[model samples]
Every structure is written in structure tokens, then in C-alpha cells.
Target chain A: MPSITVKNLSISFPLYHENTRSLRKMTHLFISGRLRQDQHKKILVQSLRDINFTLRQGDKVGLIGQNGAGKTTLLRTMTGIYEPVVGHIRVEGSISTLLDPNAGMNFGLTGRENIYLKCSINGYSKKQTQEIAESVADFSELGAYLDLPVRTYSSGMQLRLGFGLATAIAPQILMMDEWFLTGDAGFIQKATKRIENMVQNSQILVISTHSAETIAKWCNRVLWLDQGFLKMDGTPEEVLPIYLNKPYEEIVKKD
Target chain B: MSDHDPTIVKEPVIDLRSVSLSQNVKLALTDLFQGLIQWRLGWKLALLDIKLRYRGSILGPFWITIIMGAKISTIGILYAYLLHLDLQHYFTYVAISVVLWTYVNGMVNDSCLIFTSSSQLILSQRLPYSIYVWRNVFCNILILLHNLLVIIVVFTIFRIVPYTLYFLLPAAILWLVNSLALGIIFGILGTRFKDIPPIVAGVMQSLFFITPIIWKVSSLHFNSNYVLLNPLYPLFEIVRSPILGENVSASIWIAAIGYSLFLWIAALFIFSKTRFRIPYWM
Candidate 1:
């Protein structure tokens, strides 16, 4: 069986009418004037609809889409971050998601402390985390400032600590969402090696990124999503061309 | 491509049959235990939060005590004269009540926003949500400590000593339980309904008048049965009774403990179920 199976997944979000007068009319009359008030106004855009796919062990899938094409939403649903409005997802392994790399660091906490906190958050025991702390500190190259509060660190420094902490513990299934870009040049080189290492060992790797080069470099298979639908799914060589060749007008013309 | 071809390198192997969200609870509980073990870690963060607020200030946290003292004394004196209650008793009532009330108010207000305010942490790492809740609670405890300075000063000025420190056992337990229950409930509700925090703030402000924090609970001519109708009345009594040297009712203590337990279970159930969805909502 595939490591992850997603069948007919869908999500819908309700949009409230924007007109002040229409809102007043609806409230006073106990009716929905959404349709009658302004037919021209766009309302209730469907964020994700009828998404279907399967991910197996040894699959390195890259997600590509225009903004609001449900890339992040799909990742979130797959990771059990968002409950699907419809359909079911079955996963067979321990998943570690790097949806946002800095999710657990307390700004008031020192970088060294934040590392332990992040490790504990990632399900590491105190002794195990303590053992790995030195390596994470060395990789981050934060030096003595590891004892300083995270709020004091520059954005690059923060990302260094965050990235170092997350990658230290290997997970079965790894998920990343457009946060692969390491801010500093030296850290970027280190992070690239880490990603390569993770991709080699991970059962299923799902990455959502806007960078075509990134998708080309890291993924064997690519999925192209447009307006909540999977427009294309194939090897990188087969799908990247169609996505890159699309005219902006044609892409936007669909209602 | 040949076996030696770089394009066809062997895929890395990883175990895929063992991970499941069913273990989310187990992991969360484990994380909770780990946090308890590292309780000192949370206090360090809590202290940092407190210190950041007072950084560069001359009086530091003492200003909090001074301000609370000024507010309590003014209200205590004014209410005593208006209600014709003895100034000593009225001041005691206001001092203890305000200190306790601040704790209640602080927890309720901050609990709802804990997840939202800690968005950075929630998104980046897989930390247990309870850590954020506990951190906020610890911060409130610190504030409660600072506010207690006002209580000490007021009691000294009035020369009102407690009959026994044993009264504090019930009072402290009740206050802690009450705050914890509120924290859990508000923490879950605030995550679910974005509007709950504002609504709670409004309700708490309104309940301030009805709970007899400023006025004596005895001053009300209402029957004892009516006291049971007010949820906050029992909580206030828990704190106020000890300090005022009034008779602490067993019935009220039982009800408060039962209510706290119920709220704790309900909050835990709801929070555990919905915590996974918070990232989506955000």
C-alpha cells in the first residue's frame, strides 16, 4: 500500500457579502441578499475542490501552483493540520512537517533553550535532545549568542537556529512548504546538504515551492495545481514545461 | 540509464508503516509530562516575559504594585464611605478581592489569545499547546505576586492580621483551580471561535459588578440561594472568605471543586480534538 493515500479531498470556505447596505438589509429582513445586492462582485471563491492523489514510500513529490491554487491548503490537509471538508487521507508513517520552520521557538527564550524546546516539541526526550544540542549549535554556528534571546537575533540567525533544530531529528515522512530557502549564504549551503540527506532517507517527501528550479532540483515527480484542481501530474520534465508555457491571460481567464 | 548513471541512483529507504495521528494524544501527553519535568524551563520564559515588560523602567514591577495599590485604596475608601461599612473591613475586602480579581481577569483575557499570540511557535515547531497556556498562567502568577504587595501594604496600614494562615490553603487551592479551569476553557474556545475573547472580556467586565468584589457579599439582601446562581460568587468567596476572616462555606467549596474538575475535563477533551485544526484556521 502507498504510504499516504488521499481520496477525493475537498475544502470550501464561506465568504460574507461586502456591501454595507446589503448587510443591513439581510440583518433587518432576515434574508440573504448576497445574490441580489451585487451580481458583479466576486463571492465565495472555492479554495480547494476534489483533490485526489496517492503518495508512496520513495516518492519525492513537488507541488507547484500559482498563489491561492490550494498548495498550502493541500499540504495542511495532508499533514492533518486541516480537517478535510470531504474525503479521507490514510498515512502509514511518522510525519514531521516543516510547514513553518520557526513554529515553536519562544522569542523570549535563548537560542540554546529554544533548541531544547524545539526538540521537545518534535517529540525528543530530554536526554536525547541534550545529546543533539551540541551538534545543532555547531551547525547553526550561533556561537555564544545561543544564550541570547531569539528576538535579539537577526532573521537569518533565527532561521539558522530553526533550520538546524528541525533537521537534526530525522522523520519518516517529511513535508516542506516553500520555506526551503535558507536566508544566509553559508547556512544555505549547509541547508542544501541537509535537504539532500533528508530526501535520501525519507519515505515520502512532499515539497511545495514557487521556485521551478527548486522543484526541478529536488523532485522526481511534479504536481501542477490550478484553481484547486490538479492540472498536471508527471515527471518534472513532462510537467514543468506545460506550467511554464502557460500565458498569464489564459491562466487568469478561468472563472 | 546504466546502474552507474547518476540519474538513476538508488532511492533511500525509510520505514513508512509506523506513523499515525492516533499517537498525537500519546505524544501530547508525553510532551506534557516532559514539560512538567522541565517546569523550571517554563518559569525562566515566564520571568523573561515579565522582565521584558518592565525593561528600562526605573520602578520595574514595583510600578504595578503602586498602581494597583492606588486604585484599590481609592475604591476602598470611596465605597466604605458610601456604603457606611467600617473602613478597615472595606479596605481589606477591596485589597484581597482586587489582587485575586486581577489574577482571574489576567488568565481569562490572555488564555483566549495564547495560541493566536504564539502563532510563530505554533506554525514552526510541533510544541504542545499547553506550554503556551502554562507560560501565560505563570506570568499571571508573577503578576499576582506583585499585586500581593498591595495587599501586604494595605493589611499593615489597617493593622489587620489573619486569624490563621490555614485559611490560605483553601483560598490558594480554589484560586489556582478556578484560574486553571478558566484557562483551559478559554484556551479551547478562543482557538475555535475568534470572537470568544472579545465576548469573554465584555462578560468579565459586566460580572465584575455582579460578583461583589467591590461591595460586601453580606451587604446584598438577596437570599443565600441566589448566591448559588452566580458562578463567580463561589470563586470570589473562596479568596475573600479567608482574608476577611469570614466563615468559608463547605457547600461553596464543594461546588467550586466540582465545577473546576468538570471544566478541566471538558476543556481537555475539546482542546485535544481541535488543536490539530488551529493551523488551518490561522
Candidate 2:
């Protein structure tokens, strides 16, 4: 019953002069509220423009592009993270997105505590979260380290914990930036197997990764974007060969 | 990564549906209410926030209570002597005043951080935006409850038992409501401007001294009534005066209720108009 339909969806980020990277200028702008918006030039980054796609149940979508080609922005929009400024997205399913590992953690909390925190954020009950916590801890294999603060864990250890907790839920729509497999070769193999199984069972899977090999293996469809424009949409066999033929730099020319 | 790749693939395959304006307003109200209505999500995050904040310290949040007790005792003796008031009555007044002031101050200052600090969770997860605001307000309330123990100990020392205890509930309830509404607005405005949190902190610092927080309203020879014109003065008096067993002012109750209604409307309006813009701003 899960379906994703996006039509003429254009999302442009508005960057005001006062809200720029400089702290000193922002302080001046803060003190001077009388200044009008038109007093300074406005800049808007057109992250996604006129993107149209319909993804039915069981569609494994592999999103491809160079850095800042709106791949991450597109995935984020589907989960309702970034709203489309011009168009609209209609998604009929419960979406579970693993966009970035860094944003969803409190390092002061233990691994087990983080697991419960994430579960509750997903709107799970306490008893349900407790059960999910057990599986997450087991899959992460942090063992007694789950009791210690997650700050003590290495970056690799943190990634494993994030992967374990995010993939535990059986979602109608699953979105991820990359295939989060880390640690030893044995652990990588185990993670790959788990991801494959989830992709098989889930109603839809949308992954944005650079590797053509992973797309060929996991995806039936490919969405290629450049400078916020949807350039190509086709089977991996048709698109991947053409997409990979060019170097990344030439393809990533800014608009 | 496809510069040479043709922009045209196929003619549009998906239906383009126009989103109505009403849907946005509905979504905004949902964002605000969802954070409050979903008590489970709010409380869990709040408890975790408070726990993590005091994790390593020995006395934890009780440390606030100890520091507050010392401040009250020292300030009570000095201010009462300086102002020519009875020692016991003035100490009790300062104790209740400062405790309630801490709660208000904590709510205002911490509210600015609700959305900015939780930008990570907001960017990755599909949560009702106001959940972070609720967590902030709830966390401060938890600290307020802890500080109430100091009040009980003070009451025991003064041997002033409360016969009109029920009168304090409405004032306390109004205070909590104000904090929740004001906190959400602060969270939204604070997120967009990026510099608002520090500016707000500076403003609050000045407000503490300007407002009749350390001294009584009657202590002012001139502008004593004008001092009550400060919104904070009425808010502070509503809760603090009730605890001190003073006569409740009808005008104070009216001003507090009227101001609270205005804040709720303004907060909801700004929140609904700007909720979608949060991701872009972040």
C-alpha cells in the first residue's frame, strides 16, 4: 500500500545576508531590526527543481549524483525534512530515514539508552522499545559497552550502533544516505546481509550512494540529478553505463 | 553527476496535486499540539535531557537547590536590614521570590535552545517540531519541582503553615502555561535568527535587576506602581505573592491572563507561518 508520488517538485533554499556564516554581521543585523529585507541582495540555492517521479511499492531506488547535486536534499524531502517551495510530495506510508549518523545521537547517553531514546522518537511504546532495545544491543554487539557512555566509543563503534538501531524497525519506506557497513570484514559481511534482507522485505527502499556496483546489485531504477535538475531516470543498465562514462568533475559543473 | 546527461528523460509521469493553504495551517497546529499531546515522547526526552545534564556531578540538580538556599539566606539578611523590614518576613519573601524567579529565568533562557540544539534530530527524523520545545519546558518544570523542597524547608523554619494553600495552584498553573507558549516562540525565533539566544541572554540579565526580583515592589519610592507595569512584575507577583500568604490582586490576575492569551495566539501564528522554513534556516 506504500506509494511515493512527487510532481514538479522544486525546492530552493533562501539565504539571507544577515544569516550568513559571519557571526559579527549577524550580531549587527540582530541589533538593527529596522533594516528591510530588500536592503540587501538575496541568494537562493535551487537544490531541487522540477523533479517528477512516482515510486510504487517494492521500488528499490538508487539515487546518484556528484557532491551537492541534491541527492541528499531529495532524500531528505521525501521524509518531510525539507519542504518543497514550489511543488508538493504525496507519500502514503510510514517513512524511516537514516539520513546521517551524527544528528541523531546524544554522546552523553549510553548505547542502550540511545537505543531507547531513538525508539521512543519513532513513537514506539516503552515495552515495545525495551524489546527492540534488546535486539538492537544484540545486533550492535556492544555487549557491556552498552552500559558505558557512547562518548567512549570509537567513530566506527558509533556507526555500528547507529546502523543497528536504524535498521531494526520494519518500515514501509526506508531511506538511507549510504550502506552503513563498518568494522571488521566479518562485521561488514553481516551488515550487508542484514541490509539485503531488509531491502527484500520492505515495501520501498531509497538509497543515495556513489558506487555504481552497489546500484547495479541493489536497485532496479536509477535517478540521476545535476544542479537540482533531474537529468535521467531509467533502468540501471541504461543509466549507469552513460552516467559512469564521464568523470565526476565534468558532470559536477555548477549551475 | 551528469553535466553532459540530457535534462529531458521522459514526459512527466506523476500527477501534480496542488497543496491547499488550509493544509499548512492544519499541519502547523498539528506540529504544536503533537509535541504536547504526545506526552510519552515529550516526557522521555525531557527526563533524558535532565539526566544527561547532571550525569557526572555528585549532587546533580540538587546542587541548584543548595546554591539557591545560600543565596536566599545571604540576600535575605542583607536586603531586609538595608530596607528596614522584619527579618523573618523578608527572608521568607526573598526565598519564595528567588525560587519562582529561577524557574521563570530557566524557562526563558533554555527555550531559546530548544530547536537550535536539536537541529540534528530535526534534520534526520520526522518529528513534530514542537516536541523539542515541550521537552525544554518540561525539563525546567522538573527542576522547579526539585527547588520546591527548599520552600518546604523554609516554611518549616518560619512555622507559617498554609491555610490558603489551594489559592497558589492557579497562579502556578498560569506560570507554567506562559512558559510553554513563550518557550515555543523563543525556540522558533531563536532558530531563525541564530544570534537571538545570546541577545536574549543579555536581555534577561538586565531584566533581572530592572525587574523587582531581589527587592519588593513597595521598596521603590517613585515609579513603584510603574514598576508593576513590567509584565514580569505581574507574573512574578502572581506566584510569589500567593506563596507568601498575601492578598491576591484582581488586576494582577487579569493582566496575567490577558498577557497569556496574547502570547498563545502570537506564538501559534508565527509558528504556523514559519514551521516549514525551519529546515531551510537550519
Candidate 3:
């Protein structure tokens, strides 16, 4: 029953450079009765413009876009990280986002403590926390390293901990960014298997990636964004060829 | 094992829209109430903050006690000598005043950084914004608890008994309420205006000297009633006089309560108008 609905969503970020962020300038503008005039000069980067879409159960949607094309913004918006300026987004399920693996990890805390902290942040009960700790400990294979501060761990070890903790709890809606896929062969295999399990259980999955093969492999639908606009929304067979400037059969065949 | 109940009753909905005052108030109230209900998380975070700050050190949180002790002793002895005041009474008065002042001053100065310091957690999670404010308040209270040892030693040395210690419960609660109000006001302003932290620091610097922390208010020749005009005066008097076993006038209590009420109103006004913009400002 998980679903996402967006209506005329337009998001713009007000660029607060030194000029606009200063209280002195703001106060001066207010006293001079020039606040309205200065408001006209405030810079706003329209990250997403008039984007409209609906995602429902069983839809594995891949967001394809170039750099700064609002894919990440759209995902973040859906997660309620950023408030929309023009319209609304209605989400009907619990969401877990892997936009950044280390988003909430405290380096000063031990690996086990970080796991507990994440569990507590998510409002997990004590028994559930203990279960998650055991599961992450088993999956990460860190052993004694779990007792040490995360700062002492090597980057690869940190990745294992972060990845394990993030995927420990599967939500109704799973959203991810592409960079999470990078790692050694063995780790990548394990990570992919876990993600696949999560995807299978999730009511809806949305991933933003640059790889056409990723879309062809996992997604049932494709959403192509260009310069903050949703340029195309349909099945991969209909949009991938034009998006990649290659035939759809070749992309899937190579994968 | 990953099974979830597909039949979600009252599924959460986020209906975002343009900034409207009424909607902002509703959201702000909900956020504040949510944070209050999750005091456990804030309490745990506060404990962790204290633990991590002195993780590698031997004394751990005792460091707070040592620093405060050193400061109070140096000021107490020097000022008692310069003013030709009785050492026992002066030291005792200075002890309570300094401890109370530390809590107030720390809360005010640190309030500005509550939101800015936790910008990472703020952006990544969609929890109530007031949780950060509570975390900060709790952290300061923990430090104040550590500093209590210094007060206990001073009272023991002077052979002075705090008979009205029960009054401290209400006084402490008032301080807690005021700290939260300051936290919300300054937390939002500090995150929005980059200059707020420094400006707040500078204002607190002058206020410390102006407030009767190191000096005694009785030493003033002018009408002592004028000091009550300084909102901080009544707050300090309520906590300090009660500890000294002196009667606090009903007027002081009224002023203290009145100031806190005004502060909360202002805090709510600013917080409601600007709570949503905090993430973007960061």
C-alpha cells in the first residue's frame, strides 16, 4: 500500500551568500524601507521546477539525470528532508533513505555504540536494538573492531559498518543513491544481495543512478530529468534508448 | 524476518506548502511536543556529549568541577581582600553566585550553537528541531551537576547549612524553562544569521560584568530597586538568595516568572515563523 504522490512540486534554494546572510544588511534594508527592492535581487537556484509524478506499489523507478539535474533533490524532497516551495508531496509509508551511508554515524563512538545510536534514533525498542546489534555484528565481521571507536577503523571497515547498519532495517519504501554500490568484489556481492532482499520486501523502491545497466537490471519504470524538469516517465524500454542514445536491447543484453 | 504490516492505519502524510503563519504555528507546536515526548533520546545524547568530551581524560567530567573551583577560589579570595569583606561570608556568597552565574551564562552563550553544531544530524534526520534544543539544555544541566561538588565543598568549609534547599527544585525548574526558551530563540537566529554566535558571545560578556556575580548588589549606593529592571537580576536573586537561606520577595518571583513568560512568547513567535527555514538556512 506504499505510494508517493507529487503535485506541481517546485523547489528553489535561496542562495545565502555573505551579503544576504548578514543581519546588518538585513536590518539596514528594513530601516531604509528597501527590503522589497532587495528581495528582488536575492538569488534562488530553482533545483526542481514543476515536477509531477506518482509512484505506487511494485514500482521500481530509476531516476536518470546528469549532475545538478534535481534527482537527488527529488529523492530528498520525498524523504521530507527539504520542504517544497510551490506544491505538496504525499507519502504513504515509512521511508528509509541511503543517500549517504555515513549520514548519522558518529566517528567518536564505537561501532557497536553507533549501531545502538542509530537504532535509538529510529525509535527501535530495546529488544529490536539487541537484534539489530547482533545482526550487524554478524554481517559486518568486525569482531573486536566493533568495540573500538569508528575513527580507529580503516575506511573499508567503516564502510562495512555503515552499510550493515543502514540495511539492517528494511522500510516500506527504500531510496538510495548510486555511490553505495562501490566497494571490493566480495563486499559488493554481499551488499547487492542485501539490497535485493530489501527491494523485494519493500512496497516501492526508488534509486537515482547514472548507469543504464542498473536501470535495465532493476527498474520497471524510468524517470529522466533534465535541467530540473521531468523530461520523460515510462518503462525503460521506451525511454532508455533515447536517454542513453543507444538501443534498449543492447543495454539489457550487455547487462 | 523483514515483514512489515502492509495495513498502516493513520499513515504519516507530509502536506507541504508555501510559508503561511497559521500552518507554521501548527507545525512548530507539533515539533515541540514531539521533542518533549522524546526526552529519552535527548537525555541519552546529552550524556554521550559529556562522556565523549572527556573520553580520554582521567578525571572525565570532574574537569568541569576543577575549572569552576579554580575560578571561584581565585575570584573569591582576591575580591574579599580588595573589598575588606569578611572572608567566610564573602567566599560563601561568591561561591553560590558564581555557580548560579555559570549555569545562566553557559546556557545563554551555548544556546546559539545548539542548531549550528548539530547541522549534520539536522539535515540527515527529520526529527523534531526542538530535540536539539533539549539536548543542549540537558548537556548544560549535566555540567552544572558536576559543578555542584564545588558548591558542596564551599558550604561545608564555611559551616553553612542550606536549610531552604527544597526551594532549589522550583528554582532549577524555572532555570530549565528559561534555558529552553533561550535555546529556541538563539538556536534559530544563530542558524539563520551567521553573525549571531559572535554577537551573542559579546552581549553575554558585558552582561556577566553587569550582573551581580563576582560583586555584591548590596555594595551599590543607588536605589537597589533599579537592578530588578535587569531581567537577569530577578532570575539570579531567586536562585542565589534561596541558597543563602535568605527570604526572596514575592516581587522577585513575579518578575522572574514574568520575564520567562515573555521570553517563551518571543521564542514561540520566532520559532513558528522560521522553524521550517532552518534546514535551508544551514
Candidate 4:
């Protein structure tokens, strides 16, 4: 059996607004006991529709899409952050998601303490988390400042700490959403190498990124999504050209 | 040699419907399990929340102690004169009530914002939504500790005789259960309704006067039914009776425990069903 499965997933958002005229119309219908159902039919925005796929061990799948094409939504749904309005997602093993690198840290906490808190939040055992804390401190290179409150740290320092803690633990399935770039050039190089090592041993890795270069370099296969629909699925070389060369003007005009 | 007797391998059939149903169950289980694990880490996060709020200030959390002391002393003196009560006795009552009320107030105000304040964490991580509630409760306890300092100082200044230490046993249990029950209900409701916190604030302000925070329950001339009708009355009695060295009624204990358990179960049911909907709503 595949490690993870997603079938016919759809998410819809309702638009709600109150207008004086509509309220009056609703009140009139209410008094008559024959309310117009059509008046309140929700304006649905389908965020993800009929998403079907299977993920297996050693599969590095890159999810490519525009901002509103449901890239983030899909990743969140996979991590169980958001439930699908329709369909389902299954995972056979524990999954670690780095949807946002700074997700659970308290800025008031020192870097060392935040490491333990975050690692535990990510489901690491107390002893295992403490073991990783030493390594994270070393990797982040913030030195004695690791004992100071994270709120006092610069953005680069925060990124380094967040990135270090995230990449320290090995998970059965890894999900990433555009948090790969750590900003500092040196830290980026270090982080890339660390991630590469982590991914090699990871059973399943699903990454969502707008950068075609990242998909080409990191993913073995690419799943192209456009407007919440899977447009293409194949090797990076096979899908990237078709996705990049599509007529942007015509696509926007269609909407 | 094997070509003559080849073995056939068949691929598994994909049942789309069953697969989807199983996925839903798996996701639900994962969310429940995550909530349990995250509960353990919530206290640390809550401490961080408290510390962050007062960081960089010279007085630090001590400011909580100082402000509470000044407010209670002013009211204690004024009320003692107006009600013709002994200054020492009135001061002790004011000190204890104010400290306890601060904890209750903190829980009510913070419960509504638990989900809203932790939006960044909830949206990004596959964490249990209950962690926010636990964090809010834990942080309130830390603030309550700060307020305890003021209570201790007042006790010393008034030279009140030390009552039996056994008073702490029931007080601790009652406060814990009360905070947890109220936190869960308010946390769930506040997340669902945006207007709940402000309304809760208004209600609590009214409750402070009616619940004897500034006056003795014995001093009120109203019927006993009025006190019985107030939901917060048992909770106040649980905390105040022991501190005042008075006996707590068994009926009050039964009511407090019964009401808290009922609220807890209801909150759990609602939370289990609606926690998944929170990210979308937010």
C-alpha cells in the first residue's frame, strides 16, 4: 500500500455579507413563512476540488501552483491543519510538517528553551528533544545569546534558530511549504545541505514552492496544479515546460 | 527452468469510497492524539506568554503585586469606614477576594482570545487546538502567583492569626477545577463568537459587585435565593470560606463540582466536533 493517499478533496468557503435591503427581504419572507432559499445560497469559493493522488516511500513530489491555486491549502490539508469540505487524506506513519518554521516558538523564551518546547510540540520525547537541543544550539551558532529571549534576536537569528530546530528531527513523512529559504546566504547553503540529507532518508516528502528551479533540483516528480485542479503529473522535465509555457493572459481571461 | 511454471502477481484494487472514509478516520485520530501530546507542553508555552508580556520592564511581574496591593488597600480602607467593619478584618477580606477575582477575571478575558492570539501556531503546525486553552489557563495561574504576593503582604500587615493549613487543600482543588471548567467552555464559545469576550467583561464587572468581592455575603439584605441563583456564588464560596476560616457548605461543594463537570463534558463535545472548523473560521 502507498504511504499516503488523497482522494476527491474539495474545500469551499462561503461569502457572508449583510445588507439593509437583503435584511428587509429576509424579514418579510420570515413573517410570511415562505422564505426564499435562493436568497441565502452561499457564494462558494472552491479552494481545492477533486484532488486525488497517492504517495509512496521515497517519493519526492513537488507541488507547483500560483498563489491562489491551492498550494498552501493542499499542504495544510495533508498535515491535517485544514479539513477537506469533500474527500479525504490518509497517512500510514507519523508526519512532520514545517508549514511555517516559526510556528510554535515563543519569542519570550530563550532559544534553548524554545527548542525543547518546539521539539516536544512536534512530538519528540523529552530525552530525545534534550539531545537535539545541543545540536540545534550548535547549528544555529547564536552562542551565548541562545540563553537570551528570542524576542531580542534579529530576524536572521530567528530564522537560523527556526530552521535549525525544524531540520534537526527526522520524520517519516516531511511536508514543506516555502520555508526553505532561510534568507542569509551562508545559512541557506547549510540549510539546503541539511534538508538534502534529511530528504534522502525520509519515506515521503511533499514540497510546495513557486520556484521552478527548486522543484527541478529537489523533486523527483512534479504535480502541476492550476486553479485547484491537477493540471499535469510527471517528471519535472515533462511538467515544468508545459506549466511555464502556458498562455498566462488566456488563463487569467478565462477566470 | 522457472518459465514453465510462472507465478502471477496481481495489483491491489483501489476502492475510492472506502479509501476516503478510512482517511477521514485516520485524520480525526491523528488530531486527537496530537491534542493529548501538546497538552504536556502547554504549561511552558504559557509561562513564556506571561514572561513576554512583562519583559523589559524594571518591576517585571512584581508590578502585578504592587498594583493589586494599592487597589485593594484603598478599597479596604474606604469600605471599612463606610460599613463600620474592623479595619484589619475588612482588609483581609478585600485582599483575599481581590486576589481570587483577578484569577477569575484573567481566565474569562483570556479564554476568548486563546485561539485568536495563537493563530500563527495553529495555522502552521499540526497541533491540538486545546493547547491554546491550556496555555491561557497556565498563564493565568502564573499571574495569580503574582497576586498571591500581595495577599501575603496584607496578611502580615494586618497580623491576622494563621488559620489551619488544611484550608489550602480544598481551596486549591476548587480553584483548579473551576478554572479548567470555565476555561474550556469560554475557550470554545469565545472562539465561535467574536463578541463573547466584551460581553463576558461586562458581565464579570457586574458579578464583582453582586458576588461580594467588595462586601461580605452576610451583609446583603437580599433573600438567600438571590445568592443561590448566581452561578459564580459557589465558586466564590469555595475560595473565600476557607480563607475567612469559615466552614464551606456541603451543598456548595456539590453544586460547584456538579456544574463544573457538566460544563466540562459539554465543552469537550463541542470542542471535538468544531476544532477542525476553527482554521477555516479564523
Best by DockQ: 3
The sequence of per-residue lDDT tens digits that candidate 2 reaches over residues B26-75 is 77787767776777788888898889988999999898788888888899
Q: Model 1 over residues A143-239: C-alpha lDDT tens digits?
A: 9989898999999888888888777766668888878585767777889998888777776899998777676677888888887788888987788
lDDT agreement with native, every candidate: 0.72, 0.79, 0.86, 0.75
Which scores greater on lDDT, model 2 or model 4? 2
Q: Ranking under TM-score, best-scoring first?
A: 3, 2, 4, 1
Which stretches in model 2 have alpha-carbon errors above 4 Å? A17-41, A179-183, A246-255, B1-23
Q: Each candidate's chain B TM-score? A: 0.86, 0.88, 0.95, 0.84
Candidate 4: which docking quality band?
acceptable
Model 3 spans with C-alpha error above 4 angstroms: A18-41, B1-5, B8-10
TM-score of chain A of 2: 0.85
Query: Can you write out model 1's per-residue Cα lDDT over B1-282, one digit (the tens) per residue?
Result: 012443355432221112245655554565456556666656665777888788768999889899898999899999899888899888898888888788888889988987787776665544446677677888899999999888888889889887667867876876665565566568767876778989999998987887778977667776766866677777777767866678877988877777777776776666556555565545
The weakest ten consecutive residues by lDDT in model 3 chain A span A29-38
What ranges in model 4 sit over 4 Å off? Answer: A14-44, A182-185, A246-255, B1-39, B161-171
In candidate 4, position A140 carries an lDDT of 91
After aligning candidate 3 to the native by TM-score, how far in Å is the CA of B264 from where it should be? 0.8
> What residue pairs clash in candidate 1, if any at all?
A93-B19, A94-B19, A102-B124, A103-B121, A103-B123, A103-B124, A103-B125, A104-B125
Fnat values, one per model, are 0.18, 0.47, 0.61, 0.38
